[model samples]
Target: MKEGIFFGEGMKFVKDDYPDIYDAVVGLNKAAYTGKVLDYKTQKLIAIGIVAATGDETATEKQMRSGMNELKITKEEIVDALRVVLLTSGMPAFTKAMKVVSKL
Candidate 1:
């Protein structure tokens, strides 16, 4: 069985630990601020894209997996997002991310 990230005590050393609670708080803020600041769905996609774009393989993998699980993002959408990153971030980052994404 694969272990997914959890928001319990063990992860507090990482920034934005307690993601379960942090997500809730962010949700509340989004609701309060006219409910259209950054859509949750879009935020998830953007986060996955940014992580992948930056070539942070560990974070990119984690965010991609989580975003897919939580948001039902299609593999095609993930691929398309990576393509855009390739255009903007150049080959090195793109190739690195592609290797990891391909493995998944």
Candidate 2:
């Protein structure tokens, strides 16, 4: 969800130390987010489910927040994605994702 950073990484370091790399990453993000077949909102929801499935709390929270803020994705929509996460990823991931959603 961050422009050029993933998880809680510092963007300034990447921007200052690896400017080209940072730009490429940002460019990748742009390409990834551009809606083609699936809309960006749906893409965002898929992203949420993915990070949630991986059980990465910080990334999951960030993606969830980004989807909600930027795309107006609802809690219900997130929960629906979490259902898929539950099926593919299991209870622990689902619980952790639910916790993140609860905090929001």
Candidate 3:
């Protein structure tokens, strides 16, 4: 399988040791990106916010990079999303997200 930038060592281990479950997860990921109502770029931005809200620095960074690289997402748009996180998820989550965004 091609190496995924966002997928860490644990995901690689699961893909190697639990192929069936990994396949299921891969299927679910595909299903999530089908773009029934929302477009892929929008979905990716939403994913970034959700990941950031969880306070996973690595995942937030990966998602931010992926969104920018693949979807051409603007830093301004990302900051706008983080504003929502600030209002709903609080300053800590927003600050953490800002730190990642600042790096990019």
Ranking by lDDT: 2, 3, 1
Q: Tell me, by lDDT, which candidate is best.
A: 2
After superposition on all CA atoms, how large is the RMSD of candidate 3?
A: 2.5
Over 34-81, each residue of candidate 2 has an lDDT whose tens digit, in order, gives 787888889889999999999999889999988888779999999999
Error of 3 at 7 (Å): 1.7
Checking candidate 3 for backbone clashes, the offending pairs are none
In model 3, what lDDT does residue 63 have? 88
In model 1, the clashing pairs are: none
Lowest lDDT sum, 10 consecutive residues, model 2, at 1-10
Compared with the true structure, all predictions reach lDDT values of 0.68, 0.88, 0.84
lDDT for each residue of candidate 1 in 31-50, tens digit (9 for 90 to 100): 54342676555676676678
Model 3 C-alpha lDDT per residue in residues 5-101, reported as the tens digit of each score:
4356687788789989888777778777888999888888888899889888898998898889888999999998898889889989999999999
Q: Count the backbone clashes (under 3 Å) in each candidate.
A: 0, 0, 0
lDDT of 2 at 75: 96
TM-score of each: 0.65, 0.89, 0.88
Q: What is the lDDT of residue 99 in candidate 2?
A: 99
Please give me the total number of clashing residue pairs in predicted model 3: 0
Instruction: Select the stronger candidate by lDDT from 2 and 3.
Output: 2
**Residue-level lDDT for 69 in candidate 1:** 81
